[model samples]
Target chain A: MTKYNLPVGPQHPALKEPASFWFKVEGEVIVDVDIRLGYNHRGIEKACESRNYIQCLYLLERICGICSHAHTTAFAQGVEEILGLEIPARAKYIRVIIAELERIHSHLLWLGVAGHEIGFDTLFMYAWRDRETVLDILELISGNRVNYAMNTIGGVRRDIDQAKREQILGMLDPLAERVKFYTDLVTSEPTCLARLENVAPVPADKAVALGTVGPTARASGIKVDVRRDDPYAAYAEIPFEVITSERGDLLGRAIVRLGEIGESVKIIKYALQNLPEGPLTVKAPRKVAAGEAVSRVEAPRGEDIHYVRADGSDHPERVKVRAPTLANLFAVGESMKGAYVADIPIVIASIDPCFSCTDRMIELVQSRTGTSSVMTWEELREYGIRWYGHGHRS
Target chain B: MCGQEQQRSDLARRDILAELCARFPGEVGEAAAPRPGRAWATVSREVLRPVTEFLLGCGPGAYLSTITAVDTGEEFQAIYHFWVAGTELNLRVRLDRREPAVPSIMDLHPGANFYEREIHDLMGIEVTGRGKLERLAVPDDWPEGHYPLRKDWPGLPGGESA
Candidate 1:
C-alpha cells in the first residue's frame, strides 16, 4: 500500500474556523499531524498598535467570536493596570457576569462540536439548541450574540437593568437543570462513554511539560487554574471550585468542561446577588501614561494573557495576546499520536481547538510529489469561480 | 488582618528581590516596584535562559504564564512573565534590532513554543532552536517583512476605522 497525505482544511466542513490540518495517514491511523494557521489572521495584533485604548476594546472583542468577552476583559484589565485604575465593584461584578455567560456559551458550543465529531447527530442538535439559551441571555444584556462590545477601559459599556437581570435569573434554574441532565447523559451514557473514555490519554507530566492550560491540563491532574492561582476580575471574591480529573482522556476533558458549566452558573448567581451599585464606567484618560501591564484571565478554554505597553499616546506601543488554545493545540497534537483514526475527531474536538483564538501557521505540500504548491490570490478567485460557477456572465 | 498580611507579602517580595540580586550579582537588573503587587528585572539576552531555569527550579510548581515581545525600533525586547501562587517575576531580555533573534527556551520550557511563535510572527523576531518559526496569527498571504506591531511600520490602511 502506498502512503498518502490529506489536507483537511484551510476550508473544510469539519471546522467552524479557517485552519488547515494535514494528516499523514497509513491506513486508518494518522501517522503525523501538521497544523496550518494564519488563514484567519487579519493582522489583528498589528491593527491594535494604531488604535487607542478605548478603540482596542472593540478590536480585541473581534479576536474570537466565541471568546470575545474574555479577550476584551483581559485587554481592558491590561489597560486599567497601565493607568492604575481600579474598576468599581459593581463593574467588576458585571464583568464576571459577562465572562461566565461567555463561558457557558463557549462550552455548550464545544459540546455540540464534540457530539458532531463522534457521529452523534441527535446529541449535537440538542446541545446547540440548548446553547441558544446562553446566547439569548448574552444578547439580553449586551445586545449582540457574538461580539458583545460590552467591555470598556475602566469598566463595561452597559449595565444590567432590573428587567434584564430578572430575565437572566428566570432562565437560570431551568438551564442549570438542563446542564445537569446533559452532564449525566454525556458521562454515564453508554455510547458516549465507549467513544470518549480512556481515549487519547495525556499523562499529567506531559501535559505540564507541554504547558497545557485550562481543562486540558486540569484533566491530567495539574491542579492549576489561573482563576484560582492568580485571581482576576471578581473571581477572587466569588467562590467556585476548579474542577479536575486524573483520567486525562477524552471523557476526562468532557467531564471537566461540563462540570465547569455548573460552576459558572453558581458564580453568575452569586455575582448577580452581590451586584454592587455605581456608574457602569469611569472616565478614562484619552491618552494613557507610559507603562506596561500583564493581565491574565481564565477563558473557558484556558488561560488568556494580554500584555499591553502604553506610551502616553492614543495608540499602544505594544499589545501581545496569548490565547489558551495555542498551548492546548500542541498537547492535542501530541495526544493524537497513537490514537486510532476513528477517534481523531473526538480527540481533536475534546480540546475544543479554536484556531481563531489560537495563533498557528500551516503550509501545504503535496504528499505524492513532495512539492509545495502556492495558492495565489488570483487562483483563490478562480477556485471560488469554479466552485460557485462564475455566477452566469450576464 | 488582611491588611497586615498584605504588608507582610510586600516585605517578602522585597526580600525575594534582594536575594535574586545578591545571588546573580551584576546580571540582575535594577529592582523597582512596578505596582503594588508586581516586581520587574531586566537581564541581558545572554543570561535569560539561566535566570528562567533558576526561577522554575526554585519551586516544583513554577509556571511560565506567557512570553511577550516589544519592538523598540532600534532594539527588540522579549519579556518572560512567570508566576507562582501569589508573586510574579518578570525577566526582560533586550536583543539587537538588526538581528532580532534569541536562543529558544522551548527546550527548557516546551510551553514557550507557542509564545515564541507568536513573538516571531508578530514582532518578526526569530527564536532560534524552535522547531517551527511559522507565523501563528497573521494570515498566510500577508506581505513578508511587513510586521504590523513595529513602531515605524505603516499599519492597515484606514487604520483607526479598522
Candidate 2:
C-alpha cells in the first residue's frame, strides 16, 4: 500500500480553534503524526510585561475561554505568593466553588465534542444540553458564563451569598442525576463503546514519559492531580477522591471525564456548604517585593501552570503560561501510532485539545501526488464519520 | 502517622536538594524551599542535563511540567519546572545575554520538545542539540533576530506606522 500524507487544519473549523495535525497514513492505519502549533499567538506573555498586575490578570483570563478562571486564579495566586498575601477564607471557598463549576462546564463540553467527533449527534446534543445547567450556575455566581472574571489580584471578585448558595445547592441534585445518566450512557451505549474501546491506547509509562496530564493522565492509571498533589485554594481543606482508570484508551478517557463531573459536583457542594464568613478580598500592596513565584491549578483539561516575576513594581517583569494542552499534545501525537485513520477525530478530542489556549500552525504537504489542497477540520471529521459508517454501521 | 508522612516528604525534599548540592559542588547555587511542595535551585548551564537526568530518575511521579524563559535585563534565564512527588522543583539556569543557549533535554523528557522550541521562538534562545526547531509559535515571515519577549525589542522591525 502506498503511503499518503493527510493534513488536517491549522484552522480547525470544527473546534473553532487553530491547530494542525499531519498524518502519515499507510492504508487505514496511521504510521506517524506531526503536530504544528502557533496559528493564534497573541503574545499575551509579552503584553504582560507592560501592564500592571491587576491589568495582566484580565489579559491572562482571555488565554482560554473555557478555563478563564483557572488562568486568572493561577496568575493571582502567583502574585499573592510574591506579595505574601493569604486570601480571606471566604474568598478561597468562592474560588473553589467557581473552579468546580467551571470544571463541570468544561467536562460536559468535552463530552459533547467527543460525541460529535465519533458521529454520535444524539450524545452530543444531550451532553451540550446538560452543560447549560453548569453555565447557568456559573452565571448566577459570577455574573458571566464563559470568562466569569471572578478572580482578582488578592482574591475573588464575586461572593456566593446565602440565597445564591441555596439556589446553587438546589441545582446540583438534578445535575448529578443528569451526569449519572451520562456515566451510564457512555459506558454501556454500543455507539460509544464501539468507537471508544481500545482506540488510541496510551499505556501508563508512556503517559508519564510524554507528560500527559489531567483526565488524559488520570485515565492511564497515573495517580497525579494538582488539586490532590499540591493543594491550592480550599482543596487542602476539602476531601474528595482522585478518579483513575487502568484502560488508558478513549473509553477510559470518557469514563474518567464523566466520573470527574460527579466529583466536581461534590466539591462545589462541599465548598458551598462550608462557606466561611470573611471578607471577599484583602488589600494587596501595589508594589510586590522583588521575587518570583509559580502557581499551578488543575484546570478542567489538566494542570495549568503560571510563573510571575515582580521587580518591586506594580508591573511584572515577566509572566509565562504553560497551559495543560501543550504538555499533553506530544503524548497525543505519540498515541496516534497504529490507530485507524477513522479514529483520528476522537483520539485528538480525547485529550480535550484546547488550541486557543495553546495554538499552532501548519502547511499541508502532498507526500505522494505532489499536489496540495487545503481541507477544513469539518471535512476531516465528516470523512472519518463516513469512513466508519461504511465499514461499521454502528 | 500523618505527621510522620509529612516529615518523610519534608526530609525527602531536603534530601533532593542535598543530593544536588553534593553531586555538583560549585555548580549548584541559591537553593531553597520557600514552602512545602515547592523547591527551586539555580544551577550552572553545563550541569543542567545531568541535574535533569538525576531528577527524572528519582521516581515515577517525576516529570517536566514546562520550561519558562525570562530576560532579566542583565541576563537570560531558563527555568525548568519539574514535579517530583508533589513538589515543584524548579531548576534555573542563567545564560549570557550576548549568546544565550541551553542544551536540549528532549531525549529525557519528550514533553520538553515544544517548551524548548517555545523558548527559542519567543525569547531568542538557541536550544542546542535539538535539531531544526521549525518555528513553533512565530509566523514563517516573522523577521529573524527579533524576539518579541526580549526587553530590548523595539516593537517589530518596521516603523510605528507600519
Candidate 3:
C-alpha cells in the first residue's frame, strides 16, 4: 500500500470555517493529521487593547459569528469581576436566556454541518430550518439576529419583556418536537446511524487525557459541563441536566449535542418563568481599578475562558481569550488516529471546531500579570514548607 | 451563592491548591481569592510542568481549557488555564523577554500543543520540546522576527489606518 497525503480546506465543501488540514494516509487509514488555522485571523486580541471597554465588547462579539454571545459573556464577566460590579438579577436571567438560545442555535447549526458532511442534505435542511426559529427568537428579544449585542460590562444591553418571553416560549414547544424528531432520525435512520456509529471512537480516559471539552468530551462520557460545574449567570438558580454518552464516537457526539438542545430549551423556559425584575444595566465607571480576572463559560462547542487584566486605564491593559475550539483541536488530531480517510470531515466536525474564534490571538503586552514581584522557585519552596509545617502560622 | 454549590466550588479549589502545596512544599506560589468560581496562582517558570501535572492529577480528570501569554515589558508571562471539578485554576509563568523560552507541557496535556505553537508564532516564545513548531494563524510570508502580539513590534494589524 502506498503512503500518501491528502489536503483538505482552507476552503472546502466539508468545512464551513476556514482552516487547512493535511492528513497522512496509508491507503485509506489516517496515520496522522496536520492542521493549519488562522486563514481568517483579523488580529482581534491585539485590537482589544486599543479599544475602550464598551467598544471591546462589540469587538469580542465578532470573534465567532455562531457563538458571539458566549464570547461577549466571557469577556464582560472577567472585566466586571475586576471592577467588582454585580449586575442586577433580571440581567442575569436575560443573559442566561440569550446564552442558552445561542447554544441552541449553535448546536443546531453544527448538526446541520454534520449532516451536510455525510451527504445527508435532508438533515441539513431540516436542522437549519428549525435553527431559523432560534434566530427569530433572538431577534425578537435582542433586536438582532446573529451578533446579538446583549451583554455589556455591568449587565445585558437588552431585556426580555413579558410579550417577548411569551413569544420565545411559544417557539420552543415546536422546536422541541422538531429536535426530538431529529434525534430519533439520527438514531433510527439506517443511513444516518451508519455514517456516525463508531466513525471516530474516543474512549473516556483518552478524551480526558487529551483535554477535550464540550460535546466532544461529553460524547465520550466525560460528564463535564462548565455551566453546571461553575455556575455563572443564572445557571445555578435555573435547573438543567448535562448530557453525556458512553458511545465515545461520532454517534455519541451527535446524541449528546442533540440532547443539549433539549437541555438548553428547558433552561430558557425556567429562566423566563422565574424572570427577576430589575434594571438591565447599572452605571459602571469608565475606568476599571487595576486588577486581573478570568471568566469561563461553556460555549456551544466547549468551555470558553477569557482573562482580562486592568491597569487603571480606560482601555484594558491586556485582554486574553481562549476559545473552546482551541481546547479540542489537538484532540481532533488524536481522534483522527486509525480513522478512515473518508471519515475526516465528520470526525473534525465532531469537535465543532470554530477557527474564527480559536485562531484569534489573546496576546497582551504587559508583563507579570498582577505585579512584577514574584519570588524565585527556591523562595516559594521554603515558604510553602515553613507555612505548612507550622500548621496555621504563616 | 448557594451553600452547597459554593462549598463544592471552594472545596475543589482548596483541594487542588492543597495538593499542589503539599507535593511541592514551597513551589505553588501565591493564590488569589476565589472570584465567580475561578481563581489563579503564580508560579516560577521552572515548576510550570510539575504544577500542571499536579493539577491534571486532580480527581475526575483535570482539563486544560487553554493557554494564554502576555508580555510584561521585560518578561513574557505564560498563563495556563485548567478546569478541574468545575473551577478554573490558572498558572502564570514569567520568562525573560530577550531569550523567551519555556518547556512545552504537551507531554502532560496534549491540548497545549497547538496553543504552545500559536503562542510561539504570535508571541515568538520558543517551545523547545514540541518538535517542528510551525506557524499558525499568521501569514506564511510573515517576517521572521516580527511577533504580532508583542507590545513593541507594529507589524500587520489593528491600527488607525486599514
Candidate 4:
C-alpha cells in the first residue's frame, strides 16, 4: 500500500483562517494528520503587551472576528478584577445582552459554515441570512458590526436607550421563530442527520479528559458551563438552562448550540425586561495598582480565560489569554481519526475550529523521503489544480 | 475577605502548598498569602517537574489551565497556573534571566503542546525536551530576538503612536 500526503490550506477555500493540515492517507482513510497554524498570527499577544489597559480591549477584540465581544469582555473583566472595581448593574445587564447577541451570531455563523461544508447551500444561505438580524441588533446597540467596542475597564462604553431596547425586542420575535424553524429542520431533516450523526463521536469521558469546552463538551453530555459553574456578569441573576447532549457527536454539538440560541433569546428578553438605569461606566484609575486577577467567561465557543497582572502602570505587566479554540483543536484531530475523507471537512467543521486564535506557520517536509518543500500560495494552488480537478470543480 | 467556602479553598490550597514545600525542600520558596479563593507559591524551575507531578498525580488531575511567561527585561518568569477539579492550587516557577529553559509537560498532559509553543514564541524560553518548538503566535517574518513583551524591546514600527 502506498502512503500519500494531502495538504489542505494555509489558503484553502474551506478554511476561514490560514492553517494547513497535512494528512497521511492510506487509500481514502487518513492515517495521521499534522496541523500547521500561525499564518494569521498577527502577534495578538505581543500587541496586547504593548497596548495599555484600555487600548488592549480593542486589540483583544480583534483576536477572532466572530468572538470579538467575548475576548473584549473577558479582557475587561480581568482588568476590572485587578482594579477590584464592581461594574454598574446597568452595565452588567448590557454586557450580558451583548454577550448573548454575540453568541447567537457566532452559533449562526458556525451553522452556516457547517452547512456549506456538507454541500447544503440552502441551509447555509438561510443561516447566514438570518444571522444578519442579530448583527443588525448588535449594530443598533453598539454602533458597529464586528468589533463592538462596547466594553470598558469598569463597565460598558455604550448604553441601550428605550428606543434601542424596543427595536431589539421587536427583532427578537421573528428571529426566535426563524431559529426554531431552522432547529426543527436540522433535527428532523434526514440529509443533515445522516451527515452529522455519529460521524465524529467524542465520548463524554474522553471529552472531559481532553479538556474540551463550550458546546463541544456540552454535546458530550458534560454539564460544565463556566457561566453556571463560575457565574459572572448578570448570569447569576438571569435564569437559563445549560443545554447538553449524550450523543457526543457532530450532530450532538449542533443540537446543543441550536438549543442555546433559544436560551439566548430567553436571556436577552429577561435582560431587556429588567434593564436597570444607572451610569454606563465608572471612573477607572489612570494608573493600575499592583495586583493580579483572572477572569473566565463562557465565549461562543467555550471557556475564555484572561489572566492580567498590573504593575501600577497603564500597560499591563502580563496578559495571558486561553481561548476555547485552543482546547477544541486537540479534540478536532482526535475526532477526525476514524472519519472518512468525505466526512473529514464536516467533522473538522463540527468542532467549529478557530485556527485564527491559535496559530503557527507551516513547515512542510516530505513524509517518506524527508525532503522539505516550501510551497508558496500560488504553487499550492497549482498543486491542487493538478491533483484535484480545476479549482472551481473541487 | 473571609467566608466558609473561601476559607475551605484557602486551607485546601495551603495544605497542597505545604506538602509541595516539604517534598521539594529548598526548591519551594516562601508561600505567598492566599487571595480570594486562590493560593500561590513560588518555586525554582528545577522543582517544576516534581511540583507538577505531585499536583497532577496526587490530586484529581489538577488540570494545567495555562502556562504564561513575563519578561522583566533582566529576567523572564514562567508561571504555570494549575487548578484541580474542585480546589485551586495556582503554582509558579521562575527561571533565570539568560537561557530560560524548562522541561516540556507534553508527556504528562497532551494539551500543553500549544501553550508551551506560545511561551517559546513570545518569551523565547526553550522547553528543553520538546522535539520541535515552532512559532505559535508570532508572524513568520517577525525579526529575531524581538520579543514584544520584554520590557526593553522596541515597540512595533507603526505601534508607537497607536
Candidate 5:
C-alpha cells in the first residue's frame, strides 16, 4: 500500500479561500498535510508602516472584510497605548457594542459557511438571512455594511445615540431566538450530525502545544479567551462567559461558537442599557511617543493581536497583525489526521475562516495518488464532493 | 483599581526578571512594567530560546501569540509577544542592523513557525535553524535581498532596491 498525494486546495470546494493544502493520502485517510498560503496577499502590513496613525486605522480595517472592526479595534488599542490616551467611558461601551455586533455577524456568517460545507443548505440559508439583520444594524450605525469604519484613534468615529441604542437593542432578542432555532437544528439534524460529530477530534494538550487561541482553544477545553484573559476596551467592565467544550471536534467547535453568540448578545444588551454619556472621540496627538505595545482582542474567530512600535514622527515604524486564522492554522492540520475525505470541507469550515493567506511561494513536487488531478478549482471541488458522495472505496 | 491590579502583575514581572537574570549573565537588559498587566524586557539574541522556554514552562497559559520585527535605523528589534493568563510579557531582542540575525524560537514554540518565516521574508533577518526557509508572505518572483519592512525600503510597488 503506497501512500500517494491528494492536493485539496489553492482553490477547491473545501477551501474556497484560494490557499493550497497538499495532503498525503493513504487510501481515504490524510497522512500528512502541507499548507501553502498567499493566494490573496494585499501587502497591508507593509502598507501600514508608511501610513499615518489615522490613515492606518482605515487600512487595518480592510485586513479581513468579514471581521474588519476586529482589525481596527486591535490596531487602535495598540496605538492608543503608545499615545497614553484614555478614551471616554461612552466610547469604550460603544466599542464593545460594535465589537459584539461584529462578532455576531462574523460567527453567523461562519455558521452559514459550515452549513453549506456539510451539504445542509437550509441552515446556511437561514443563518445568512439572519446575518443580514446584523449587517443592516451595522449599516445603520456606521453607514457601511462590511468595513464599518467605526473605530478611530482615541475612540470610535460616530456615537450611538439614544434612538440608535434602542434600535440596536431591539435586534438582539429576535436574533437570539433564531440562533436558538439553528442550535436545535445543528445538534439534532441527522445531516449535520452525520458529517460533523466526532470528526477531527484534537486533544487539549495538542491544542495548547500548537499555541491555539480563542474559541478554537476554548472548544478544545483550553480555558482561554482574550476578552477574559487580557481585558481590553470594555471587556474588563462588561461581564460575559468564556464558552468552551471538552469534546475537541467539529461538533464541539460549533457548539462553543453557538453559545458565544448568546453571550455576545447579553454583553451588547448590557452595554445599551448602561449607555455612558460623554464625548465620542477624544482629540489625539499627531505624534505617538517612541514606545512599543501589544493589543489583543477576541475577534469572532479567535485572538486578534496587533503589535505597534512608534518612532515619534507620524508614521508607525512597524505594525504586525496576527489574525486568529493564522494562529489556528497549525491545529487545523493537526485535527485533519484520520478524517474521511468527505468530511474535509466541514472540518475546515469548522474552524470558521482561514487563508487570509500571506503572499508566499512554495515548490509543488507531488507524487501520483493513483489517478492525478490538473483540474480547475471548481472542478476539484466537484470532484471532491462527487467522490465523497459515493462512499469512496479506495 | 486598575492601577492596583497593575502593581500586582508588576510583582510577577519582578520574579520573571530575577529568573532570567539569574540564568543568563550579561544578557538581560532593563525590565519595565510600562502599563498594568504588561511587562517588557530587552535581551540579547544569544539567550532568546532559553528565555522563551523558561516563560513557556512558567504556566499552561504561557503561549507565543506572534513575533514582530522592527528596524530602528541602527538595530533591528525582534519582539516576541508571549501571553500568560492576563499578562503579556514582551521579550525584545535587538539585532545589529548591518546583518540582522536572530536564533529561531520555532523549536520551542510551534506558533513561532509562521511568525519567524514572516520575519525572515519581510525584514531579511536570518532566522537560523529553520533551514532554507520558504516564503510565507512574499511573492515567488520576489528577489532574494529585498526586505520590504526595512526602514530604507520605500513602501511602493517595484520600488524595491536592486
Candidate 6:
C-alpha cells in the first residue's frame, strides 16, 4: 500500500480554527502526524510589553474566546503577586463562581462538537441548547457572554449580588439534570459507544510524558488538577472531586467532561451560598516593584500558566502564556498514530483544541510530492462524518 | 490533613532548592523564595542541561511548565518554570546579548519542544543540540535575524529600525 499525505488544515471549517495538520497514512491507518501552527499568531506577548497592566488585562483576555476569563485571571494573579496584593475574599468567591460557569460553557461546547463529529446531530443540538443557560448567566453577570472581562489586576470587576445569586442558584438544577442526561446518553447510547470507545486511546504514561492537561489528562486517569494542586482563588476552600477515568479513549474524555459539569454546578452552588461579604477589589498599585511572578489557573481545558515580569513600570517587561491547548496538541498527534482516517476529526476535537490561543509560530514544511492528493478540510470533515455514518447505518 | 500535605510539598520545594545548591554550588545565583508556592534561581548556562536532568530524575511529577525568554535590555534570560510538588521552581539561565543560546532539554522532556523552538523564533535564542529548530510562530516571509520579542526589535522588517 502506498503512503498518502492528507493535509487537514491551516483553516478547518469544522473547528473554525487555523491549524495545519499533515497526516502520513497507509491505507486508512495514520502512520504519523505533524501539526503546523501560527496561522493566528497576533504577537499578543509583544503587544503586552507596550501596553500598561490595565490594558494588557483586556488584551490577554482576548487570547481565547472560550477561556477568556482564564487568561485574564492568570494574568491578573501574576500582576497582583508582583504588586503583593491579596485580593478580597468576596472577589475570590466571585471569581470561583464565574470560573466554574466558564468551565460549564466550555465543556458543553466541546460536548456538542464531539457529538457532531460522531454523526450524532441530536446530541449536538441538545448540548448546545443547554450551553445557552451558562452563557446567559455569564452575560447576566459580566454584560457579555464570550469575553466576560470579569477580571482586573487586584480582583474581579463584578460581584454576585443576592438577587443574582438566587437567580443563578435557581438555574443550576436544570443544568445539572441536563448534564446527568448527557452522562447517561454518552455512556449507554450505541452510536456514542461505537464511535467513541477505544478510539485513539492515549495511555496514562504517554499522556503525562506528552504533558497533556485538563480533561484529556484526566481521561487517562492522571489525577492532576491545578485547582487542587495549586490552589488559587477559592479552589482551596471549595470541596469537589477530581474526575478521572482509566479508559484513556474518546469516551473517557466525554465521561470526564460530563462529570466535571456536575462538579462545576456543585461548585457554583457552594460558592454562591457561602459568598463572603466584602469589597470586590483592593487598591492595587499602578507601578509594580521590580519582580517576576508565575500564575497558574486550572482552565476548563487544563493548566493555563502565565509568567509576568515587571520592571517598576505601569507596563510589564514580559508576559508569557502557555495555553493548555499548546500542551495537549502534541499528545493528540501522538494518539493519532494508529487511529483510522475517520478518527481524525474526533481525536483532534477530543483535546478541545483552541488553536488561536496556541498559535505562536508558523512552519512551512512543503514536503509534498507526486502521488499524494490533497483533500480540502471540508471534505475531510464530511468524510469523517460519512465514514462514521456507515457504522451508524450498519 | 490538607495542611500536612501542603507542609510536605513545601519541604519538597525547599529540598529542591537545597539539592540544586549542594550539587552545583557556585553555578546557582540570585536564588530566593519570594513568596509561598514559588521559588526562583538563576543557574549558569553551562549547568542548565545538567540541572534539568537532575530535576527530571527527581520524579515523574517534576514537569516543565514552560520556558520564558526575556530580553532585559542588557542580557537575554531563559527561565525554565518547573512544577514540582505543587511549587513552581523557576530556573533562569542568562545569556549574553551578543550571542544568546541555551542547551535544549527536548530530548529529556519532549514537551519542551515548542517552548524551546518559540524562544529560538521570538527571542532569537539559538537552542543548541535541538536539530534544526523549525520556525514555529512567525511568518514565512519574516526576515532572518529579526526577533520580534527582543527589546531592540524594530516594528517590522521594512519599518523604522528601533
Q: lDDT (0-100) at residue A111 of candidate 2? A: 90
lDDT of 2 by residue, A93-140 (tens): 999988899899889888988888888888888988988998999888
Alpha carbon lDDT of each predicted model: 0.76, 0.85, 0.79, 0.75, 0.78, 0.84
Give the alpha carbon lDDT tens digit for every residue of A1-394 in model 4: 6566666555432222345677676755667876666666656676666678888988888777788888888888888877878999999999999999999998898888777666576888999999999999999988888889999889998889998899899999998998899889889886677777787798876775566788998999876677765678988778888889999988998899999999999999999999999999898987799888777889998888888888888898788888887777777777777655556566667877642221222345556777766555434323423432322222
Task: List clashing residue pairs in candidate 1.
Answer: A9-A20, A36-A362, A37-A361, A37-A362, A360-B136
If both were scored by lDDT, which would come out higher, candidate 1 or candidate 5? 5
Cα lDDT of model 3 by residue, A246-349, tens digit: 99999999999999999899889999999989899988999989888888889998888888988898988788887777777778778888977556667777
- List residue ranges in candidate 5 displaced over 4 A: A11-18, A354-371, A375-394, B1-19, B22-26, B154-162
Question: In model 6, how many backbone clashes occur?
Answer: 6
Spell out the clash pairs found in candidate 3.
A366-B71, A366-B72, A367-B71, A367-B72, A380-B26, A381-B26
Best candidate according to DockQ: 2
Residue A21's lDDT in candidate 3: 74
lDDT of 4 by residue, B1-162 (tens): 133244234223335666667787877665763444355778877767777777776543346767878876567888786655443455677778777899987777776777888788777888987797877667767777766666676666667434
Tens-place lDDT digits, model 6, residues A81-152:
888899999999999999999999999998988887777879889989999999999999999989999999
Tens digits of per-residue lDDT for model 5 on A48-149? 877999899988887778778888999999989989899889999988988999988888988887777766668778989999999999998999998889
Listed for every candidate in order, the interface RMSD values in angstroms are 4.9, 3.7, 3.3, 5.8, 4.6, 3.2
Q: Which stretches of candidate 3 lie over 4 Å from their true place?
A: A12-17, A354-394, B1-14, B156-161
Using lDDT, give the best candidate's number.
2
Q: Give the best candidate by TM-score.
A: 2
For candidate 3 chain A, the 10 contiguous residues with the lowest summed lDDT are A356-365
Would you give me the overall lDDT of model 4? 0.75
Candidate 5 per-residue lDDT, tens place, B123-161, comes to 898998877787776767777787888878754456553
**Candidate 5's TM-score:** 0.91
**Candidate with more favorable, higher DockQ: 2 or 6:** 2
RMSD of each: 7.7, 3.1, 13.8, 5.8, 4.2, 3.6
Candidate 1 residue-wise lDDT at A182: 89
Measured against the true structure, the TM-scores of the candidates, in listed sequence, are 0.86, 0.94, 0.88, 0.84, 0.91, 0.93
Q: What is the interface RMSD of candidate 6, in Å?
A: 3.2
Candidate 5: share of reference interface contacts reproduced:
0.52
Tell me the tens digit of each residue's lDDT in model 6 across B33-134: 876778899998888989888877765566788899999999999999998765689999989999898988888888888888889989999999979988
Return the candidate ranking by DockQ, descending.
2, 6, 5, 1, 3, 4
